[model samples]
Target: MAEGFLRPSNGRMEDEGNKYFNDLLANSFFQYVKRNECEIVTSCKMHDLALQVSKSEALNLEEGSAVDGASHIRHLNLVSRGDDEAALTAVDAKKLRTVFSMVDVLNGPWKFKSLRTLKLRRSDITELPDSICKLRHLRYLDVSDTAIRALPESITKLYHLETLRFTDCKSLEKLPQKVRNLVSLRHLHFDDPKLVPAEVRLLTRLQTLLIFAVGPDHMVEELGCLKELRGALKICKLEQVRDREEAEKAELSGKTMNRLFASLAHKQGTVLSMIFWRVVCAIRQKW
Candidate 1:
């Protein structure tokens, strides 16, 4: 609905686009369910009548709908209810641009040629099938909070991928070493701080890198090359920084980083002073 209201002159909406949402709440179209201590509504439950009306207009291919009538469907969400495995197994939506699933496990020799976004958050998928590399057009993928352990090396073939998220995937021990080949990558979210490789300097287009652990293989100076970094950055094991010169080379002040958290393994007065001054400079620039 907000997309429909964008101005024809600029293709952008002037407001935050909450007017329709407020109107719905005012007219009792949606029931408020939860609120924060500040009295801000946090959750809303749509009236059953509205839900039914929405389903009546949308084609849910997962509900035993015929694929013959779904060739034009651009979005597909496969929500499993234990018995819905057969429904997922029968899906053949090649034209689908988005595919989201919330299932314990996905059983597939799957193929979606045109898919651009794939999210399988919290699923029991332990590994991505080799066929996933065939998605040449895939741009966004989130397998966060899952039981995955390792990603196939073929994942490096996703040259067009822009954002990859695997936060809270505790069992994942490593990422493809050639991940830097993804030149288009802009956002990378991971749970383990040590998982980031020094080769990340190759991803000069990166904007959001949540946790960076300084280690023998990944030096803090490597961060100097990532001038596009934004948002918050948490650099752990700061003791690995060789000297003040190396810290200066990180170029933290050159970027638009808003928040920074540094954990030092050493408490030497000189080192601490240098780090403190650099951080203060960065913070001052942010302000």
Candidate 2:
């Protein structure tokens, strides 16, 4: 997806992408697939037999070492394998594009103006420099399982960003307010659905939103506006909904998803018994 290899010209990109992926899996190109409760593949590993054929395409660098030659290098994988610190010493970065890092980048900033993908999953990093706006071509960023608490507001400047995943970052508070400015955004995966920005409905191209929490500032209809949404979605704070008319506006019945979960456990007198009953019936009728 980061390379636009599965991008489709029509319909939802994820739908077409998943079809191609299943084809590859059925053909024995992928192995050890892991699926979620919704039966969606979450992770997978390539067969070692297939790895040998593509070994030359991937270069393995030693820990705490300086880069020697970097004329045609585009991808760098520094996912921590041990306690050694990964150093970016003597590296001549000119046009590097991708970086998968799990260790603290030391020795230098290792900033490459042409960098495209940056995955810092399971790292000790805390914050991103506001200077990240310089990566105009950046398309993918995954900071899952990290200590990062906040993202620089300048990240909204990357108009080309399509995927921004920060899942499992327990300390993170919320997404940038100007996130809607990322016109090309297609996916926003986070751990806390309540932390999602209120203006996220503006991202019309969005396809995957696993959870949503209705609040005073957000309406239930916001999820309905995202026509491309798919996969599993859990809607929390269903008691916040006012009436059946409002719930009808959510159009949950027409949503093309695998499973739907609604939680009204916190219901209070705030929702009248008669109104709430009609509202539940309205939504269920659609489903």
Winning model by lDDT: 2
Residue-level lDDT of model 1, residues 1-287, one tens digit each, is 21133334542132233456677878887896576543335589988787677553233544544544444456666655343445434445466567777763235544577778888887768898766788888888899998999988888999988889999998899998899888878789886886895488889989889888888888777788898887778888776665566677778877866678777655658756676566545433524
TM-score, every prediction:
0.72, 0.85
After superposition, candidate 2 runs with Cα above 4 Å error: 60-71, 81-93, 265-277
Model 2 CA RMSD to the hidden true structure, in angstroms:
3.1
User: In model 2, which range of ten residues has the least summed lDDT?
Assistant: 83-92
What is the lDDT for 141 in model 1?
A: 89
Q: What C-alpha lDDT values do all the predictions have?
A: 0.71, 0.74
